[model samples]
Target chain A: MNFDKELDARGMNCPLPILKTKKSLTDMVSGQVLKVISTDCGSVKDMQAFADQTGNTLVSQTEENGEYIFFMQKK
Target chain B: MKKMAIIATKGTLDMAYPPFILASTAAALGYEVQVFFTFYGLQLLRKDLSSVMISPLANPAMPMPVPMPVMVQMLPGMESMATMMMKQKLKKHGVASLQELRDLCLEAEVKFVACQMTVDLFEFDKSEFIDNIEYGGAATFLGFAGDTDICLFV
Candidate 1:
């Protein structure tokens, strides 16, 4: 999928991945997409919660070789 | 915007993680968040965190390398050892340190209010805490907490 930025949150635990995602989204303009790669299993739910609470769009989420990949668009 | 008020009442290293983590995340979610540090919880606002060690004796759920009886956990150096092990595990899991998490909360504009009564009761010097935080009594915090959508006492 097309993305304007990429955040590698692999190996980072709970709040770190969400925190970094929030910070990254802040730097982008509305409608821009961000690709986040995380290894923390909990991030699967966290990213969804973050997207729901923040009003960002989680365009797609997929898993491959234990890595959770997410595409989120700024609101 | 939604608002959140958290009363932090624990001081140990393990207990410290919840308030900061939740505050920062809530702030990031565009909520106006405030954490009120009272009693022993005020230790989290101190400039030096050397005293914020965890005690295994208080936490039976803590996983240990071996089965540790209550008597063993009560040893003089057990607290320090447990704290060190927890710190290592946190680092290995890429969890932010308490100091780092607190800083993130501050950067996210999560208000930190230290309980003035606790400071007086505990005889803690005001200068011992980090700058850029507010000192107030329960009423001062309630002024905000009373109307907030989320109120938590951790």
Candidate 2:
């Protein structure tokens, strides 16, 4: 399925990238996907916790060219 | 299902901004946000407001070249300078001040709570605070936070 949004939070510290991602997701409907890119090492855990807490589905996570990408579907 | 509660206990100006900013943003995102101020954090609720509070110079958590006490002493008029810089920066970026943010939160029907124990400890009258403030204890705030989708301690 086509992702509904992309959030590039590279170089941002913890909480900020996750906070921004949450803000972006607020406007999306259920089943819509969001693609997140971040450079913070803490983001892996932060995003995972965020998805679990918000009941959003984390579709996939991958790393490429030194950046981390997370695919999530809004719940 | 958007709801959040932010517990604010720091008195320093820099530290104070996080809770207000986060709470305001949450409200803007349609979350039913509540900010509970306790301990030294009550300084933000003072009616006879002075300049924005400044962070303690000697925090262990602060990255160091200079110690905090020395930093505070070295920078005469730095508190005002930092406050002014923050004001300008927020305005430039469309972020709001604590007062303005508090107003917006009220306008949006977000909850603002002051810890009753803190008010008593600091010898402040409830009348001395801005309007729309609710009074409560830890239990009260905890009850609200229990069902919240987000909870932050700042």
Candidate 3:
């Protein structure tokens, strides 16, 4: 998927991934997509929750091997 | 905008993580977040966090390299060892340090309010804490808490 920015949050746990995502999105224009790759299993649900609360769209999420990949669109 | 009010009353290393974690995360999610530090919890606002150590004594859930009986945990230097082990584990998992979490909260504009009563009761110098934080009593916090969408006491 095409995205305006990419955030590598691998190895970070809990709020770090979410916080980094929030920070990254603030730099992008609305409707632009962000690609985030994370290794924290907890971030799968957390990313969805963050997107839900912030009104940002989690365009899609997938897992390859042990890494979780997420596409988020800024609201 | 949603608002969150958290009352933090414990000062232990393990106990300290929750409020800061929630506050920062809530702020990231677009919530107006406030954390009120009272009693021992006020230690979190201290300029130096090096003294914050986790105690394994009486905490059976603490994951030590070996199963430690409470009697063994009570030995001298055990707290330091436990704290070191926990720190290593957290680092291995890429968890943010307590200082990092607090800094993140501040950067996210999460309001940190120190309990004035506790400060006075403990005779703590105002300069001992970080800047850009408010000092207030219960009523001051309740003003925000009463109308908040989510309120927690940690």
* Complex DockQ per candidate: 0.89, 0.07, 0.96
lDDT per residue, candidate 3, B1-154, as tens digits? Answer: 9999999999989999999999999999999999999999999999998788899887878767878788888999998888888889989999999999999999999999999999999999999899999999999999999999999999
lDDT of 2 at B60: 52
Off by over 4 Å in 3: none
The true-versus-predicted C-alpha distance at residue B16 of model 1, in Å, is: 0.7
Highest-DockQ candidate: 3
Predicted candidate 3 versus true structure: per-residue lDDT over A1-75, tens digit per residue: 899999999999998999999999998999999999999999999999998889999999999999999999999
Q: Report the Cα lDDT for residue B142, model 3.
A: 98
Instruction: Give model 1's DockQ, 2 decimals.
Output: 0.89
**A18: Cα error in model 2, Å:** 2.0
Error of 3 at B141 (Å): 0.9
Give the proportion of true interface contacts each model preserves, from 0 to 1.
0.88, 0.00, 1.00
lDDT of each candidate versus the true structure: 0.95, 0.75, 0.95
At residue B37, candidate 2 shows an lDDT of: 92
Cα lDDT tens digits for candidate 2, A3-68: 889999886654456667777887899899999998777778877877776678889888888788
Worst 10-residue lDDT window, candidate 2 chain B: B55-64
Task: Kindly list the per-residue Cα lDDT of model 1 for residues B43-105, writing each as its tens digit.
Answer: 999999888999889688888999999999999999989999999999998999999999999
Superposition-based RMSD of candidate 2 using all C-alpha atoms, in angstroms: 6.0
Per-candidate alpha-carbon RMSD to the true structure:
0.9, 6.0, 0.9
User: For model 2, what is the alpha-carbon lDDT of residue B77?
Assistant: 75
